[model samples]
Target: MQALKHILYFADGEFGPTQAFRRAVALAREHGARLTLMDVTIESGIGADLVKRFGLADDVQQSEQRLWALTHLAEDWVQGQPARLRVTIGTPFIEVIQAVLRDGHDLVIKPVRERPSSRGLFASTDMHLLRKCPCPVWVDREPEHAAPRQPAQPTDANADPRCIRVLAAVDATQPDSRQLNRTILDTAGAVAGRDDAALDVVHAWQAPFDGSLPGAGPVDHDVQLADVLGLLEREHAAALTALTADYRTRLNGGDTHLARGEPAATILAHADALASDLIVLATLSRPREPGLFIGTTAEDVLQGAQTSVLALKPEGFVSPVS
Candidate 1:
């Protein structure tokens, strides 16, 4: 597996840029990777007018000042680590993607700032970048200050590194699920292998049914309910076991977990329990409708998972049989 050589960190109004910059610098130094810090300033007419009104004579100068301050801050924080600085003015997501492609970066890191609305809509930039970026995207949400300053010590109790943990979330019912599951497993294994960290394979299964009272249907249904649940449980266990068998062999240190409940809730609970550093999930490929692609489980996980998430695009599927 080719390790990420170049990483692009995107900064903007959200507190994420600073955290992304810091993490990128640390990882780059640890991995001998090159780092580029980019700040995207939108040139909307209103934004431009506001900049001018604020006594900024030249937009370029203002941008340069911001970049300089950020670059210096990163340099001082990293303490002589080598990194490139870039500042671009345009649509934030477009600029970041273009930079990634132009620079041939292997990874892109951005802070995930939840939108103020209760609907759990991420900033437009985050959604756009997550959906379209070709390389792996790491969306950090925890405040930087909350993170530990020193690297995690290696011992039997604290053998895992402080670097983010990657959980591959899969829907085992769909035939295509295996492809996504394998991709996530392989990618996550590669990441864990690189850092000598722990990788966990997680599948969230839910009994398919509309919410309804149990006894409302029929007395005869009562006896069949146990059979139905037993069948579902058996199928879920078989699927999880088959999926993990080969992967467990490939990743000697990895572990598999299966949970029965609401998909999002179960997955989040496991992630929280593990204190996962990151999650790797495959996006559902439904028709492009507002809220349609976001499944109930994925929506819940995306909005509520307390760790960073890496959502793989559905277009990357490659069948395992072939």
Candidate 2:
């Protein structure tokens, strides 16, 4: 949640220099943060003899070529914005996370992989970074087309397809989620402020029960269940209010929503209703030992999301890779 001092922009393969890369440059310019553009080349599976026979570039040569290509690809976008270029040979996600660990990067920004089918939301590397990256990871949705830009002005509906609206989902009722909720809000606020966007906050709660009570008839059981649900709603509302008290000015009056339903479904519905350009959420909410963890709700939201996502791990999160 601290100011982003160092940003790592991962432009793996041919998906580089897109909206996400431009976004990284803009952020670095705004925050005076150091930016690094990186790429990874997976080693070929061919035998050494066959590789030599084919006159293919060795690993060192491949890395050097990748580095040059990355630098050239970013030249127009970076425009001498003071960014470092790097290329490593390995698995993409592992190399990216290791770079973050090695260089103390505070944020990882990358474009979402293009999918052949819409059944799966994130690719394997995207999921790996979301689940195991130590720093905050932003997977930007690939834009269908470029929008016309106005000189030195904030994005608006007339100019950009994105609504410039941000949806922040928080889990406020649980003790373990309080810190993560704060982090989510802080990060959301920063994005909204930077982009001159509107921020809306949502919390979803559920009250589960069977139809019939142990010693009650249908009517009585229904009445009791209704009362229990009402109480649960009140409790959830109170908790959400308390959690967002410090952010009252940032939220104003009309930006908070409390709903009763499944967490993932509710959050996605709320985001769609608001036409949010971005969703700020905690990838892992529950308390767990230091390792890779992504909550069920987070996974569902990510899979169902139609907009870009910024996911953060908990305070003590540790990557499983090295």
Candidate 1 lDDT, 267-290, residue by residue in tens:
888887877777787655432444
Which candidate leads the pack in TM-score? 2
lDDT per residue as tens, model 2, 182-207: 99999998787766778899999877
Q: What TM-score does candidate 1 get on C-alpha atoms? A: 0.75
Whole-structure CA lDDT of model 2? 0.80
Error of 2 at 244 (Å): 1.9
Regions more than 4 Å wrong, model 1: 13-19, 29-33, 44-54, 77-82, 117-122, 143-161, 164-166, 194-196, 211-219, 249-255, 285-296, 315-322
Worst 10 residues of 2 by lDDT: 152-161
Best by lDDT: 2
